[model samples]
Target: MQFATEILTSFLAIIVPFVGVFLERGCGIDLLINVILCCFGYIPGIIHALYIILKY
Candidate 1:
């Protein structure tokens, strides 16, 4: 589960930024947010991205 969380968070951290930028027009959750998310904890990041994914 930990490994899965790591992979998923990394994947979202990799792809979501560009998509977010494109969709939102130049601004989104910054890179620091991604790094902190992966480092501090994956669950928060996963939850946040999931909400973004599900909601929008």
Candidate 2:
């Protein structure tokens, strides 16, 4: 289960940082905004995800 969760988190972090943020940081305005940014561009999503992970 732990392995699967890690894999899932890793995958989500790259392709869908909003989901990754939710998994790592919990639901909030930041999650919503990041999701929108992801829809706009993948790079921004990645940056947002990394920022969230590193920030907290």
Candidate 3:
């Protein structure tokens, strides 16, 4: 179950880092930050999501 959840989060991160970060750590300022990064650039968003998933 953990593996599946991680996989899902990774996929979500690639597509929408905002949702991925929110799912990983629940809704908060981080989610808003990620959304802003995503708007600025895709790479930043994906990197932030991966960092979030790996960090927590």
Root-mean-square deviation per candidate: 8.8, 2.9, 0.9
- Give the per-residue lDDT of model 2 (tens digit) for 1-56: 97676667767788778878898878898898888888899899889887776665
Off by over 4 Å in 3: none
Q: List model 1 lDDT by residue over 1-56, tens digit each.
A: 95565456446534653333233233545434544565667666555454444444
Following a full C-alpha superposition, what root-mean-square deviation does model 1 have from the true structure?
Answer: 8.8
- Decreasing lDDT order of the candidates: 3, 2, 1
Rank list by TM-score: 3, 2, 1
lDDT of 2 at 27: 87
lDDT of 1: 0.47
- In model 2, which runs have C-alpha deviations exceeding 4 angstroms? 1-11
All candidates: TM-score: 0.38, 0.71, 0.88
Steric clashes per prediction: 0, 0, 0
Alpha-carbon error at 19 in model 3, in Å?
0.8
